[model samples]
Target chain A: MITVINSILTILGIYFGIGLLFGIYFFLAGARKIDPIINDSKWTVRLLLVPGAVATWPFLISKLFKTEKQ
Target chain B: MGLDYQTILWNKHKKVYDKLILAFMLMYLLVFAGLTFTFNAQTTIETLIIRAFGTLAVIMLHIILAIGPISRLNTSFLPLLYNRRHLGVSMFLAAAVHGVFSMIQFHTLGNVNPVYSIFTSNLDYTSLTNFPFQVLGFVALIILFFMAATSHDFWLKNLSPSVWKKLHMMVYVAYALIILHVFLGAFQQETSPFTIGFLSIGFVTIVSLHLIAGFNEVKTDTKKSEKDESNWLYVCRTGEIEEDRAKIFTVDKERVAIFKYEGKLSAIHNVCKHQGGPLGEGKIVDGCITCPWHGYQYLPGNGQSPPPFTEKVATYELKLVKDKIYLNPEAFPEGTEVKPVNC
Candidate 1:
């Protein structure tokens, strides 16, 4: 049981680590494109949203690449 | 959209909504507690509190989720949409109470940290009957906490409406986690058919309401129209639009709302700048297009918020050919001053 719990914890840690990295990238690169309303926000406010950003990155990615109709 | 924020900018409507919510919560707790004490006097107080709050929170969440689709299907239900954030925050508080009492009751007095024991003490992941349901509840609680903490215009302004909206969409994820938590946890121990039936009904109701609302929207969007000379889409006869009301059109997959007010016609992007609400669905209030969702307003001519505010939306050029409204598919840059054509 101890070994199984440890393995689960290890997998969770790695998953969140990767999510955090993607969150950092989203904050730096894709936030403005996905949402122009954040243009005037402070860096600290942006940083606070990192966890949520990581969790919802798939939706952001779609918005980032969405082409506006002519 | 106010220049400054209060804890809550309470109005008569909000005050009444909040009072109703509180009354319902108190009544639910009272009845639940009374029934438990009468039927099973052996049950502890902590267990009673946990079950009562947990069930109430889930019930409130169902109501919150239902309000959106119900309002879409019938506009009279829009009153419920006004103070929905308050409902969300209240639900979170109830869930927090359930979580705290649960943690103290089950995981405390152990050799390890209560928070740490929550994850490590229940390691039966391979078995469906014992799959550490507490962890699922914990994850759902974390998501709810984030949502409730940021359920303010301050976060809306700082995080941007789109990102804030995306973040709040995690409610669906939390809902799924909670469903799993209840199904695998209490259902395993209780094995009562009534409880399982109730949960199944709630699940089906939410899913069906969403599907029905989505189908209605698709039907509206797919309505056919015509085109005119110079390739501009023919929206509708000017007479089709009522005074101070808008006729929404989908031009090349983008929604445009053409409003007729004060003997003039103007077209603007249908999505509101504040929360992507349907501008066309709203009526012209005080000579400005008011968003039905939150009362965000914009002048129809320039698609800009009236002076002292800076929000803007894209505008489209319109032509009047003998009372027929022809709209150019191209959108001008947001905040551009477009001349309104006299009807």
Candidate 2:
């Protein structure tokens, strides 16, 4: 039972770590380009969105790096 | 934009959308319940409602997600996008019914709180086959609750559209969790090939639709242009853009909409201030560029909303040489009064 609980804790830690990284990237860079509406959002509001930002990073990444054709 | 908010800001179109949703949900519940009761008379009512609403919620979610890409790929499907929030809220209601009933039936009457049992009773985290599926559903439900709670324009305004949109994008996370919930819970208990096949087909259909729409957008974004000068790029001929409409061009990674209205031409950032909707897709309504997504209007020249509204988009300089439209790749600060050129 202890082993099962430890395994769950480890998995959750890794999951949240990845989510936090993506969330930080979204806050620093992707938010402005992906959606201009969020450009002036408060820091607290931005922090609240970390979990969602992490979850939807795949779609947001495509939009973020999408550049204009010269 | 109104001061007071109703339970639902019902209009003729919203009424129609709600009627269709109700009719579909009722039809689905009746058919599913009827079939279950007929096939297995011994199945309890709680189980029947759980299955019926669970399936309906998932189906509505697929429809909700599909509507975005479908509308983007084909403008004819825009009506579906207009009242999509109602569909999302309705889906959450259905899922809530399923979740509540399932909790009452399975998790209640145990030694602990019903909600507590949902997480604690299922402790087989290491084993994929016997994983805690209810935990997945619980997490998904919490996400859906937040999404549904903030589905109104009031929240969009208060939270700012960017934060609201990002928060709602958690629907994809909820979707993944729901998929895992069904696969691990029901699929394990019920080995019916029909159920498995149905879920697989729905998943494949959603993935394929998104891919097709994404590829189409990529084609638009990657369109090549001929540069005429250092900061100015050639857009298209004057005749190319229809009166009261726009010809959107991507220059230096920024989208610009060149509009022709009343024998005058203007260029502005393609992205709308509201919800990042594509302003180019909108037409001139009463001499202002009206966003198709929500009818948020902005003057084409200065890219500022009319009096009493403060929304704005960046404007660009436009010049006509030999009937060809040339736009400056550099954008002016938003709401700069760049006068429209006579065409």
User: Best-fitting candidate, measured by DockQ?
Assistant: 1
Per-model TM values vs. the true structure: 0.83, 0.82
Tens digits of per-residue lDDT for model 2 on A6-65?
576567557657766877987676555555555555555555455456655555565556
What is residue B45's positional error in candidate 1, in angstroms?
Answer: 0.9
Candidate 1 per-residue lDDT over residues B1-343, each given as its tens digit: 5554455657898999999999999999999999999999999999999999999998999999999999999988988977798999899999999999999988998987676688888677788878899999998998997798677665576557988898899999999998888887767668878777878899999999999999988887777668776889898889999999999899776789999999999999999988888999899999899998778899998999998888899999999999889999899999889999998
Model 2 CAPRI rating: incorrect
- Backbone clashes, each candidate: 0, 1
**Candidate 1 Cα errors over 4 Å, as ranges:** A1-70
Q: Would you give me the overall lDDT of model 1?
A: 0.84
Candidate 2 chain A worst ten-residue window by lDDT: A61-70
State the displacement of the C-alpha of residue A58, model 1, in Å, after optimal TM-score superposition. 19
CA-lDDT, candidates in order: 0.84, 0.83
Error of 2 at B76 (Å): 0.8
TM, chain A, every candidate: 0.62, 0.59
